[model samples]
Target chain A: MAKRTPLYEAHVAAGAKIVDFAGWDMPINYGSQIEEHHKVRKDCGMFDVSHMRAVDVTGKDAQPFLRKLFANDVGKLTIPGKALYSCMLKEDGGVIDDLIAYYFAPERYRVVVNAGTADKDLAWMRQQAASFDVTIADRPELAMIAIQGPNAREHFWTAFPAGRARTVLLQPFQAVEWDGWLVARTGYTGEDGFEITLPAAQAMAVWNKLKDAGVAPIGLGARDTLRLEAGMNLYGLDMDESQNPLESGLGWTIDLKDPKRDFIGRQALAALQPARQFVGLVLLDRGVLRSHQKVFAPQGEGETTSGSFSPTSNKSIALARLPVGVELGDTVEVEIRDKRLQAKVVKPTFARNGKAMI
Target chain B: MSIPAKLKYTATHEWAAKNAAGTITVGITDHAQEALGDIVFLELPEAGRQVKAGQECAVVESVKAASDIYAPIAGEIVEANTPAVDAPESVNKDAYGTWLFKIKPSNPSEYDGLLDAAAYEKVAAEH
Candidate 1:
């Protein structure tokens, strides 16, 4: 049987197309995926992202334990409520998952991981934290809602007037606790937004309140397109245990500068020279770019990590991992079906925060 | 839902209408277009391409995914829909009105194998 989130019934009531995603019954769309995509880009939209796992790590040893576990240095999060985006890597420098760690104190941190990789991430965290006196618990009792787009924050504040605390005034990548809720001014969409995590039993009320406030309820369909347009990496398609973070456009998140911090993947990462670099590709011609498509450069071969039609660009674009020698402005060909279509390599980010950044 | 009683449909969802010129004007069913969602690009067969029954002849790409448009009967393509290709979203707006292509079947009796509007509706409903 497929797992169901707290908002499964709500999605069904909204006439959403339900599909089994990562062992969970989730909404693909309410009616039209295109319309949903436009709504988020043009106005305020909300998503029931409750299926994503939120694991809290608490103990006196949490700081040192996370610094040793993650490829990125968690020591940088000195201020409470500040968040750090990092990739959890295997001992051999393979990417296990990309996640956001929110620091509440020296001994307390909360990390949100992808739903599909939740089980594996939890097990790995537990195994590593066993000797550090840190407690890792998956908060299934909590539900997460991501309200995104330019008007997302304003609409969320309007939904619960009393719920908006001084923490709601927090800057981006910051989390604040208020009224039994953890409202993080962070989101996956390349838009101004907030991801609110609250008790599951109170989720329906919050969703309804937001709906009454005229926030458009979006689904997985628009979420994928939005993230792609923003140039954010989707965990499974962009990188996996089979690939290293350095090759998947996540090298910036890895902190090799901290010589004192010996993370799990430190030695492997230091020993291996980066053979390939991830670059963004904007299809100059017709045809949608898709994952697993072979990218051909004059100098070397490459493969598309995440590719799709950008709703903002109205053209196909992708993130391709290519030979480290390739630079921006170089041309390449992507094999789409029987034809090899021409593409141009651009800088990493193509769009962000509901606007084109390229 | 817009299946005309006078038209016949293939299991693959292409609808065929017997044109006055002894050729059949074909388009995908409304159900098929809706399933595909917001058509972006369409590749129709050339006017002279020979097609076999159940053969993949055309390609329709939507924002979500791509699908193949199959030939309903053994026929020679007489006319291709150039207007529909230029404005593919018209298929989503009015699928029955925007014909894909015209085919001259070698045997008219092959039309007997096609499903009528009522039968096609039942097939679509099953999905």
Candidate 2:
């Protein structure tokens, strides 16, 4: 049997179509995926992201432990409540998972990981922390809600007016904790938003208040399209344990500045030459792009990692791992069925903040 | 959600409505459109083409995935809906009103062998 989040019944009451996602019964869409996708781009929409796992690592050894664990250095997060996006890798530079690390202090930090990989992440972290004097605890009692879009913050303030003063001055990637809730100015939609984590028991009440205040409930269908259009990567579909970040358009997140810092995957990444370049594709012909589609270019053969129709661009866009010589504006072809359709290479991001980039 | 009694349905989810001109108008059922979710592109059957029953002649790609539309009976294509192909979302809005193509049946008696609305409803429920 699939596990259900605290807001599952609320989604059912709103007539959402539920599907199993990472062993959790999650809403795919309320009615129309396109309509829901537009809602987030134009106004604001709420998503029940409670299925993802939050973990806390706290002790004198916490900071050093994280510095050794992630590809991105936690040492850069000096300010309290500042977050860094990074990938945890295996010893051979394979991606174990990508997560956001929130630095509350040198001794206290929190990390949120993808739902399907939560168990493995915890086990890995715990095993690695065996020699360190740190406590690794999973926050299963918390429920996460992401309110995203151009007008997300205003709608969020309108829902819980008391939070206005505390979060109004928050910058992107910053967070604040109050009333037993952690409110972060971070989101996956490439929009202005807050992902709030509060007590699971209070989730239904919080969801209801947001609904009454005009925050529409979105689902996984729109979530996928929005993130794809924003040029963000999905965990399992875009990369897995078999792949490394250098070939996944995530070299910026890896902190190579500290040559002495021997993170888990640093040695393997330094030894290997990246064979592929991560880039974006705009379909020159009419068709929706899907993941695992073959891409043909003059440089060599490549493949799309994740793809879909961009409602904002009114065309199909994709993130692809292509040959190193493939340049922007190069015309490539994608095999969509029995036919090869023309496409143009572009930057990975197609849209952001209510605007279409391509 | 709607299955008209006057029309016939195939287990594959295409609806065949008999026109007074002795031609069969074909569109996907409402249930099919709902399952597909936001039709984006369509490749309808071309006019003046001969197709046999269960032959895949049309392709409907939604925001979710692409699906094939098969011929309900052995027939020669009389006409294809150009306007519906241009605005594929019209199928999701009104599946019955938005016909994909019209079939000039080689043997009109083949239509009788197709499932009626009630029988089709039972088949749709299993899905």
Candidate 3:
């Protein structure tokens, strides 16, 4: 049986179409996914992200433990509630998972990881922390709700008025914790929003309040499209255990600033050179681009990692790992079934902040 | 759920109706549109293409995923629904009204082999 989140009842009440995703029974959409995508891009939309796991690493050795565990430097998080997006890597330089780590102090840091990789990630974290004086606590008791859009923050403030006072001035990539609520001004949709992690028992009430404040319930179907339009990578779709961050358009997330820092996968990453460039494709033809579609380019053959019809751009778009020689403005052919459809290469992002960048 | 009494349905979720022109017109069922969410694009079969029964000849893409529209029976494509192809969401709006393509059936009697409203409802329900 698939695991259900704390907001499963709320989702069912809201008439969501439920689908089993990565062992969790999650809402795919309340209705039309395109409408939900537009709602997040244009106005306020809330998502039940409770399936993601929150692991609290505490103790004197917490900072050092995370520094070696993630590809990004945890040392940069000097101020309280500063969040850093990083990729956790295996020894082979392949990505284990991408996560957001929020630092409160040297002794306490919270890392939120994807649902599908939770067990494997926890095992890896524990193995890495065996020598360090750290305590890894997987908080299954917590629930996450992400409210996003151009007008998301204001609506979130409207939903929980007292939350405004604490989180109002929080900058992008920052978080604020009070009582059981940890409101982070970070999201995967590339929009201005907050992802609130709170006590799981109180999730239904929070969802109700947010719904009452005109924050429409969005779902995974919209979430996928929204993130895709934002040029954000989906772990299983865009990159997996077999792929590295450099070829997955996540090179920026890997921190190499600290020369003294010897992290996992650093050797493999430093010694090896990447032959592929991660880029975006705008479908010039009248068909949708799906994953594993064979891409025919002048430089060499490439493959689409993630593909979708962008509601923001009103066109089919995709993220592809192509040969290094493929440049922007170059038109490539993608074979969808029998026909080779033309697509133009561009910067990996398609839209963000209620604007279509394509 | 709107399984029109006049039309026939395939287990794959496509609906077919004999038009006034005597050619069989095909479109996806309403249940299909609901399952697919929002229709984004339609890849219709060419006007002159030949197809066999249950042959996957076209595509109906939604925001979430792509689904194949199979030919109900063997026939030569007489006309592709240009307007519905141009605006695929029309099928979502009215699946029975927005036909995908028209096929001149190789055996017109093959249309009788298709499931009727009562039978299609069972198939739709099983999904």
DockQ for each model: 0.53, 0.82, 0.93
Model 3 chain A: ten consecutive residues of lowest lDDT: A156-165
Q: Could you give candidate 3's per-residue lDDT for residues A1-358 as a string of tens digits?
A: 9999999998899899999998999999998898999999999799999999999999999999999999999999999999999999999999999999999999999999999999999999999999999999999999999999999999998988988889999999999999989999999898999999999999999999999999999999999989998999999988988999999999999889999999999999998789998999999999898888999998899999999999999999999999998999999999998789999999988999998999
List, residue by residue over B1-127, the lDDT tens digit for candidate 1. 6888989998788999998788988899999988877677788889999999989988888777778999898899999999787788899889999999999998988987899888888899986
Query: Which of the two candidates, 2 or 3, achieves a greater TM-score against the reference?
Result: 3
Candidate 1: what is its chain A TM-score?
0.97
- The Cα RMSD across the true interface for model 3 is 0.7
| lDDT minimum window of 10 residues, candidate 2 chain B | B37-46
Docking quality level of the chain pair in candidate 1: medium
**Residue A54 local lDDT, model 1:** 92
Residue pairs of candidate 3 with colliding backbone atoms: none
Best model number under lDDT: 2
**Which of the two, 1 or 3, has more TM-score?**
3
Model 3 quality (TM-score): 0.99
Candidate 1 chain A has its poorest 10 consecutive residues by lDDT at A160-169
Residue A280, candidate 3: alpha-carbon lDDT: 97
**Per-residue accuracy of model 3 over B1-127 as CA lDDT, tens digit each:** 6888888999999999987777898989999999999999998889999999999988999987899999999999989988787788898899888889889999999999999999999999999
Q: Which parts of model 1 are misplaced by more than 4 Å?
A: none
What is candidate 2's lDDT per residue for A191-256, written digit by digit as tens?
A: 999999999999999999999999999999999999999999899878889999999999999998
Q: Clash pairs of candidate 1?
A: A190-A353
TM-score quality measure for candidate 2 = 0.98
